[model samples]
Target chain A: MEDLFLKLSAILTGFDDLDPKLGSLYYKELMKASGPPFTALLQTFSSKVLGHAASTGHPASADQPAPAGNPEDLLRENIWNVMDFQILSQAIINLWYTATLKLGNVTWVAPPEAYFDSLLWRAIEAHPPAVSGGYFGYWRYPPEN
Target chain B: MDKNYDVIIIGAGVAGALIADKLAKKWKVLLLEAGEKGRERVELVGSYLTATAQTLGSPYKPVPAPAKNMAPSPDGTNDYYDQPPGTENPMVFKSTYERRVGGSTWHWLGNCPRLLPSDFKSNTLYGFGKDWPITYDDLEPWYCQAEKELGVAGDHEQLNGLFGAHRSQAFPMNRIWPSYSDLKVAEALQGAAQQWSDFNNEPMVLFCTPQARNSVPYDGRPVCTGNSSCVPICPVGAKYDGSVHVNKAVANKATLSEKSIVTRITAAKDGSITGVTFIDWDGREHSVSAKLVVLAANAIESPKLLLLSGLANRSDQVGRNLMDHPQGEGLCVSREPLFPFRGPPTTSGIDKFRDGAFRKDFCAFRMSMGNDGGGRTQSPANVLNQLLKTDFGASLRTKLREKVIRQFRISFLAEMKPLPSNRVTLSSQVDDAMIPRPKLSFNVDDYTMKGFDRIADVMRSILLALGSKPEDLVLPNHSTPFLAAGHIMGTCRMGTDPNDSVVDAECRSHDHKNLFIAGSSVFPTGGTANPTLTIAAISLRMAQSIDNQLKMSQT
Candidate 1:
C-alpha cells in the first residue's frame, strides 16, 4: 500500500507542468480506465517501501499503542469509519511522502536512475486525464500554441 | 363590462396589505399580486450560501449583482438585477425591492420610525413639491396603531428639543437592551446632542427610534435573536412581515390570489373602473370587477399600473413626483470595536440634526451600526482569490479570516429634498409579456451630498470623543455611493390642489372619483426615517375614508 501510494503521488507531480494536449489526453485516460492496472503497479512499489520500513521495527502505527480491544474487531470497522474524505485525502498525500523517506535506504528493484527521475510517476501521470483540472498541480498544462 | 370590482388594490406590500385588510372588512376588495407568495421562502431566503447567491453580497462573487433593474439572463437560471449581459439598460443601482407577495417588507430591517412633523409641511417651508393633505396630528393616532401591530420596542423617553411623535400607547413590549458596543456609542452622543443644542436645543427630546421588530415577545412573536439577517428573512419569525397580516386577513375572509399579475384596470365609458384583467403565472387571463379601485403597489408599479390602465394621465401626476429618503453612507473611526457583528435590530438614534431653522436644505439622523468586514466575511475560496490578487499562499487564509469579521460600523440615514424630475416612468424595453419596464431617472443633489458630509464629520467627532482612533476612520466618499434605502416614497404625492397632487388629503385620486392611492406613494416628503410607520399611519387614515365613502353610497 505504501509503495503504491508513493508511485501514485510521484506520477501526479510530473504533470504539474505539461503540454496542454498531453494533459487533456492524460485527464481523459484516467476517467476511462479502471483501478486494477494501476493497482498492480502500485502494489509492487508499496510492498518494497513497506518492507523497508517494517524491517526497522518502527512502524509509525506501532508508536500509538492500541487500546485494550480486539484487533479483529478494529479491522472489521469500515475504512470510511476511520476518516472522512477531506482527512483521507490529506492523509494519503502525507503518508506517501513519509513512506518515501522510510524506504530511502533500500535498493529499489529498478535502481534510482531507472525509477526516481523517470518511470513510476510518469506512467501514473499519463494514465489519468484530469476532470475540471486535477488536484494540486497534476491537472495543469501550459497554454496551447 | 369585462368585469367590475368594488375596489382594485394593486401590489401586495405592507401598505397594500393594510388597505386590503381594512377595506375588505366592509366592502368588496380585489387584491392583485404580481409575484408569488413563497418566493422569499424558496428563492430569496435560504442558507447563507444559497441566500448569498440570490442576494447582492456573497463571498464567491467580487461584485454581486445590483439590487434592481435588468431581466433574466439567456439561461433564465439567474435574474441579475444590477446588470444583465444583453439588456438595453445595463447600469444598476442598489434599490432591492421584491415584487412578490408582502413585497419588500419581507426583507426590511424592521426599523420603523415616524416621519417628523416638519416632514409633513416641507412644501410650505422650503417651497418644493406638494404639501401633505393631512397633517402630523391627523396621522399621529395611525402611527400608534402601526406600532402596536408591528410590536415595536423603544425607550420613548424625551431627547433633544423634539419629543418625537406621541405614541397613543407605549411600545408593545419594553425596549431592547443595547449591546455593550451600542451603549458606548450612545453615551458619546448624549453630550453631542446637548452641544448641538438648538437642533438638540429644543426643550424636549427622544433618544432612540422605535422599531417594528420585537425586543421581547409581544402579541405572539418571539424577541429578535440578533441574527443580523434582518435584510433577508427571520428564520425564527421575530420580526414583523406584511405577509403575517395578509395571512390573518385571509383567515378572516380576505381573498388572496397569488401569482396574479394584473395587466390593466379596465374602466367603463364614464371613466369609472369596471374591472381588472390579469394573467396568472400559468398564462391564464382572469377578469375581476368591483365598484372601487385602490392602488397600493408601491411608488413604481402603482404608477405603472395606473399608466397601463389609462387612469394615470388624468392628473398627469401618477408617476410624476417620485421621491425617496435620499439615503447615503458615511464613515467614522472608533478606537474600540463596537461589536457591530452582534445586536438587537437598531435600538438607538440621533435626532440631533433632524430639523433646524438654520440648515436650509439638510436633515440627517444616525441609525444603528452595521458591520464592515474587510472583504473577509466572504467565502474561504473567495477570500483566497482576493488575497491571491494581492499576495499568495500560506499567509492568505490567516489574513482573510481576520479581515472578514469586522465588528464596528455605524450608518447614518439622511433625507434628500423632493425632486419632481426624479420619477418612475415607462422604458422602451418590454417584459416577458411585452409590457414596458419602469424607466427610473434619478440623481442625488449637491445639497444632499453636503448634508451627508456634515453628518459624517459629526459622527467622526463623536466617535473620536468616545475614544476611537482617527486612523481607523472610514470616510463618506463616492467609493460607496448612497444607494436607495428601498423606502420608496412620494411618487404619487398628496396635495391640497388636484392639479399638483395625484391623491387628495384623504388619499383619494383627484382624477378618478372611485380610485384611491394608499401607501408611501402619496407621501409629500419622507423624513430621514424608515417609512413603514408613516405608511401604516396613512393606510389607517385611508381606511376610514374608504369606509366613509362606502357608507355615503348606502345613505
Candidate 2:
C-alpha cells in the first residue's frame, strides 16, 4: 500500500526522489483526508499509469513528454482530466509538496520532519521557512544546487 | 509589608520586561502579565511547525487557553475591535498582539530601524502630525543603549547617517548579510533603474535592515540561523523577544505573575495611583499596593485600562490618534534566478523614501525588499494551484522550479498621520472578563493614499528596471490596497502640553505624577520605521527617570 501510494506521488509530483519515510506519513494523512476515494486513486494510478512508467524504466521527465507533454497522454486524459481522480491526484501532489492537510475544516499540519522533507523546498533549492539549518548569513550568497 | 512592591508594571511586554529588568535589582518590582507563562523555545518551535495557520499566535494555542477573567489579546486571525456606526473603511484593525508573558515580540519580524531625526520634527518640517516633545539627540544615547540591550545587528557604516540619523555608538554586532535577492535587486535598481520613476529621481540604496536577531552569540543568546519563519517563531532563541528580559527580571528577584490580569487601577482622591486590583487565572480577585504603577499593556489595552479606571484622562487623550503603518506589496519574476524564502522575511530596504520634502504633500514610506519570494502571495501554492492545469510528473516539478526561482516581491510601509478621530474608545460591548472591549474608529486619509500611489510608482520603476516585462508585474490590489504593519502607535501619546497629551517626555502621566506608561502608545507622530527599537529606547529612558524620581523621594 505504501509503495503504491509513493509511486502515485512520484508520478504526480514529478520528483522521482520522494522521501520514503515521509511517503508513508503522506499516504496515511492523504488516505484519512480524502477517504475511500484515495484508495481508488492509488489503484487506478497504479494500474493505468504506474505500469506503463515502470515498464519504460523511467518516470515522466521534462526531457521527454508523453502526450500533450505527457507520454501516450493516457495519464492526463484518463485520470488528470477526470474530476474525481484529478482531485485525489492534486491532493496527493500538494501533500508531498507542502505536508499540509485540510481536515475537519482545520489545517492539519505534518510533523516538523515532514515540513523539512517537503519536496518543494528541494525543488527550489531552499530549506523550509524558519527551519533553515544553514549557517550564519548564508542568504548573502546564491544557494548551491 | 514584606509583599509590598516599589513598582507594579501592568503588562509583561517588551517595555514592561525591560523596565522590570532595569529596576529589579534596585527595587522590588512586580511584573504582571494578562496571559500564560512564557513557553519554552523548543516547544514553541514545534507548535509553529504543526500550526496550520502559522500566524503569530498559533504557537500559543497549544499552551493553556486564556483565562475567562483575563483581558483579551489574540493571534492576528480575527477581528478584535468594531468600527463605529457608518464607518467608511470598516475593514477592521489588521494588526494583532499576543496574550503571552513575552508579549507580541514572539511574532514580530525583528526589523529594528530607528526613527530619523526628521521623524521627530515632522510637525515643524512637514506641517503635518505633531512634533515629539523630545529630540532624536535626547534619545540617541538611549537608542545606542537599546541597540545593545536588544542585541541589534546592523551596518554602522552604511546606516550611520543614511538619512542623517546618528548612531553615537556602533551596533552591538555586524549587520545581517543581505539575501541573494537583495544583492540582485540592488544591482537592478542602479543607474538606469533610477530613471524608472521621474517622481523621485534619487537613487534607491538597498542596505541591510538593522534587526534584533543575532549575528553572533550575544547576551547568552545563540546566533541567528536565517530561519525564514521569524514572524511566527524563531526555532532557535536567536531573535530577541520580551521573554529574555522577563526571565532576567525574574532571575534578579523581581516577581512575575502570569495570568494576573489587572482590570482596574485603584487610585487615591488626589489622582495618584495607589495600587492595582487584578484577577488571577482562577478568576480570584487580588490587589497589590505599589508606590509607582507603569502601564505597559500596548497602545490599545493601555488606554482601555485608563478609561476603565477613569484615571489620567484630564487631557482627554487616553486613546486618541491610533496609528499603524499602512503597508502593501508588488511581485514579479526576475530575469536572474534570485532564490528567495531564506533568512528573515526582509533583509534589506530602500531608505530614500523614508524621508524627503515630499512629506509636505503625502506621508513618507519605507520600501522593504522581501526575501520570501511572493511572500504572502504564497508562491508554492501559486505554482500548485496553477499546476495540473496542464502538465503532470516531471513537467510540474520543472515548472515549480522555474517559477519559484524567479519569484520576487517588494513591500511598501507608508506612514500614517495621527488624527484625533482615529481613536480607540471603551465599547458598551464586554469581553469574558466583563471589562469593556475597545471600539475602534479608524480610517485612511488622502495623505496616506498619496503615499500608496508613490509606492505603486516605485514598484513599477524597479520591476521594469529588472528586465521584467510590464505584463509580468503583479501590482497592488485596489480593493484591499493596504496591509496592517502591526506597528500600532499613538494611543496615549506624549507631548509637552498637558492639555493635549496623556504623558510627558518621560512617559509619566501629566495628571498623575507617579503613573507611567510604556510602549508605542506614547508615540506622538510615527515615522516610517518599525516602532520596537524606539519603544525600547523610550522605555529605558523612562526607567532612568523613574529611578531618579524614587531616589529624589528617598533623599
Q: What is candidate 1's lDDT per residue for B260-345, written digit by digit as tens?
A: 77888877887776668888766678888877777788777778778778784556777765666555443443554443333443
Which lDDT values do the candidates have, in the order given?
Answer: 0.56, 0.83
lDDT tens string, model 2, B435-549?
7778887887788887776678878888877777778898774576577889889989999999999999999999999899999999998898899999999999999999999
DockQ of each: 0.02, 0.61
- CA RMSD per model (angstroms): 14.4, 3.8
**Highest-scoring model, TM-score:** 2
* Docking quality category of candidate 2 according to DockQ thresholds: medium
User: Per-residue lDDT for A1-145 in model 1, tens only?
Assistant: 4333433343322223323332233323322342353344333323333322333423335553333333222211322133332223222222221111111232112112221232112222211001112111111221121
